[model samples]
Target: MSDKALDEEHEKYIKEHSALFANYAKAEFMIKHNYISKQDRLDMAEKQEIALNRVEKQEKRRERLMKQIIPRFVLYFAIMTLIYLFFRWLSMYT
Candidate 1:
């Protein structure tokens, strides 16, 4: 009930869950006050790091699939073209 007691309780809450409190505060400010804080910027940076990591993983997967597919397609096309030319020459001679 006393201001000092409330302050102590608030400090304890902050210490126990600093990251959660910081995120909640940022959300509250963005929603209610329509203002961004320093903590919000830090949170955005952290989220960007996660997003970049996800994008990097996706790109690696795309590269691996491309590596597998390109050679197979090239080989298939070359075989098909050779077969077509061989048939065309045989038909002309017959």
Candidate 2:
């Protein structure tokens, strides 16, 4: 390829392949993806990524809240029952 003659021969070979290239079929060319540019694809990717992050953040917050907080009624009912039993035992025995 360094010599002029070799470069010319490779160029001729590449030209022959280009000459044989076929045009796209009408059905294939009409597909939506074929019409989307790189910037459109990137924009869609960014929107989807933001949505995914939002969902993930909400899920993690929900899980953390579930772990940290107890239902108030259950805790209060148990504590009141124990106090009532303890007082009843004191009244009966003392």
Candidate whose lDDT is highest: 1
Give per-residue CA lDDT, model 1, range 28-57, as digits (tens): 667577577778767876875675576567
What digit string (tens of lDDT, one per residue) describes model 2 on residues 1-94? 1369657855865664453332123323434557756676676557656755765675687577656555655788899999999999999988
**How big is the positional error of residue 68 in model 2, measured in Å on the Cα after superposition?**
2.2
Give one clash count per candidate, in the order shown: 0, 0
The residue pairs in collision within model 1 are none
lDDT of 1: 0.72
Error of 1 at 82 (Å): 2.1
> How many steric clashes does model 2 contain?
0
Q: How close is candidate 2 to the true structure, as a TM-score?
A: 0.51
